[model samples]
Target: MKTDPTYPLFPICAFLGFIISLVPISWHFQAWNAGTCLYMFWVSVACLVQFVDSVVWHGTLNNHAPIWCDIASKIIIGAGVAIPAASLCINRRLYIVTSVKTVSFTVEDRRRAVYIDLAIGAGIPVLVMILHTVVQGHRYDILEDVGCIPVIYNTIPAYPLVFMWPVVIGCVSFVYAGLTLRAFLQRRASINDVLSATTTLNVNRYFRLMLLAFIEMTCTVPLSAYSIYINTSGVTLAPWISWSDTHFDFGRIDKIPSVIWRSDHAFYVSVEMGRWIYPTCAFVFFGLFGFASEARKHYRMVWMFLAPRISLVRLNPRCVQFRIIGTMP
Candidate 1:
């Protein structure tokens, strides 16, 4: 099968995104809370997986690394849920800090909030991973350029089992974001006081967090809903069978042909969107926070650390001294 022209771009984009997503986590680590950390972690992991997948199976259905695919398939499932889960934590935290009732939070209250965020951000994804087995139609599907992805039987149960969590989490996050926005509007004059009293956020970081959550919710909810609609509509799904029959369906492994993907416009759109969305999210995140004053400080520190080392390996000593002498004039 001829390779899609866009296939080569996947690995490059994913790899760049992976690198970009790591900047805040590695450099300005202290600026983020558990929720932001979790979100970046999920994005980085997903980008790494996509990078590997694109490199391994670009324009081919060769299962070069089956073991890796097994692990990656599961990671993809968890990552899908974890991202929105993390966003929920962010919005929920904003809601808590902005609530009028939270006049001042003690250390214990802060610890409790962290625990709650961890539970929602990390716990729910684990639960979803376990629940995914019920609707998993087969081992996995190896698609050209996309590598291995879990196969969910488009049965009645799959809707609740696998497809709904992102939308559900997104909707809940929207509610929290709405509440937070209302609180902010009402307390605009004293917003910094409200945040400083309840959390570590200053005006800048607080608004950034809010904007991040809002944008993520707006994108995730509609995309997830549309994904569900496209995957379900205009297709005759296999009848619902017993859990065993659905889970252990015959032909446990399959390689999707590229023609099948290209033939259907909606299917193609969904597939491409799934492939590109994580990198897009990473880029969006970088755009939102990568240039913050704290991030820039980290950037300067990184440059400072690297500059001396780079200067030590002078390609042209004569040119370097000449440049130094030029500065004297």
Candidate 2:
């Protein structure tokens, strides 16, 4: 099946997601919204991975920049997988869990927690990619699969390394969020009391934040499943298309080493479909839904700043004409 017709949409989605993520990132004041910044950081990374994928996949440069193309392809793919999940994990552990359970919070505590989150969020991906590379035989060649370079897939380590941990973390978060939501909803803690009422409001607020994390998990988990399915399925998946040079309608696909990670036509195309689309969904969801109220505030402020400038620019042309006439006189 000629899937190339749909290829154009992925890049467009990637670019759009990248642009949307900037809104929350810009609004983030770390002191007030530290967890949000942590979450948004990974969301931005995922979007960035897609944006780069859009560029190199459809363009002519992927194969030529082997080191960059190969290393970046793996790292970003890992980033795409690990970062958002790690962000959610961190947000749940530090913010939601801590708040509801009355967990202690000290200056060093937050610092240590954030450092851990950043390290895990960023580190795991790199480590996974490297391990994947080693296990896969370190193939640095142009992975001219589908329209773009495919990430590490179909490896033994991928399940535990790439997919399992995130799944576990997301599950833990969802359960805690559910429990926390129950506490707020049931009002068993005596809603008539002012202190309890305030606690409900606080828990409700934290639960909403957790919901945002859940939304991210909803977007990402399916992508991972789809990848695992297509790769591991017994059915003959796209036997018609080759992941090799024969499938290449254009460009010089050089022979490079093969890694432990492998790809087939079905899996490659399947991956392309999900890669940008998931992150795009994630970025848009968080950008619009997660930050809806905040976004409106920011949007109003931006309009206030830009409206006068726009009016001035509109008025400038006439002023320029008048000034020209006056100078001539």
Candidate 3:
């Protein structure tokens, strides 16, 4: 086997991903989970882990970090955040279609929609984790002159590699979501016979689906473009730079001797471009949080709208309203 230094961080990140995915399942059984709510819950876990890991870990670790550790941390962190955005957009599409309908669709149909979306968002990551483990042995190689804990800055090659999966998944999901919403919109005015729903309900579904698609694509395009730029460039910020102040006076020729060496052009380009792209990702992340906030607000509105109409009793008398026959005013 080749001596590669980054093996350790992989297990850590993958384990974190598993934990993130598992929590929603637990919530499902424990929290009386609604289908739409479960998707949001799953997304929250992914986003939290990614946000914490990327910002905290990268801020500390310097170059000479291990390969496996670096890659694992980034992948887990990026996916944690990006996946939730994707899932929410998907959930929005499903909810707008299914929820507003007054038709008596089977429980199985609802469950099928939920599981299919889950598979699209979470299933791919699970498969990738398994494949990575099987192909590469579990242990990660530690980097020289690095702290025991894994960090992203010290780990150079791993940065682009880490975002590879998340970018692919996010872009694909965004495209699918956009197309689905567009199709729905084109059919909007022509939805002649919706399943026993009022005109207001039909209008809500039409508008919400389009809104979800718009949000998903708008947020994802920046992230995907940034990821692709970094990946293609093949350079990373110096892990050492991330840690130490490199601003010491090089003008002191008496105190220090500078040695010139042949530079890798590809590496230089990667570093320069990555600087810009990284911040683009940060912006994408902020946009996603905004999207989630909007979703929470929308969910509350949905519940509020439904509350007056729903009842505990199967055949509540309140479900019907009677009009008095012609009485003298």
lDDT of 3: 0.41
Model 1 scores worst on lDDT over the 10 consecutive residues at 314-323
* Better by TM-score, candidate 2 or 1: 1
**How many clashing pairs in candidate 3?**
19
Clashes (candidate 1): 0
Write down the RMSD of all candidates, one decimal each: 4.0, 8.2, 15.3
lDDT tens digits by residue: candidate 1, 1-329: 75676766778899988989878876424533779888888899999999998788777888788788878888888888899999999999888778766557677876787788789988988888888888888878998767888777888877787889999999999999999999888878887667676446777778888899999889889989999999888877877879778867634679987777777889889888887988988998898889988789887676657755755422342443322423553
Task: Tell me the tens digit of each residue's lDDT in model 3 across 115-226.
Answer: 7656655565555544343222123322121222212322443334444565555566566665555655665564445523432234433344345445555655575566
Tens digits of per-residue lDDT for model 2, 155-209: 4544665556556655655565555556645654542342332322243344455
Question: Pick by TM-score: which candidate is best?
Answer: 1
For TM-score, candidate 1 versus 3, the one ahead is: 1
- lDDT for every model? 0.82, 0.51, 0.41
Clash-forming residue pairs, model 2: 136-259, 136-260, 137-260, 139-257
What is the TM-score of candidate 2? 0.66
What lDDT is obtained when candidate 2 is compared to the true structure?
0.51
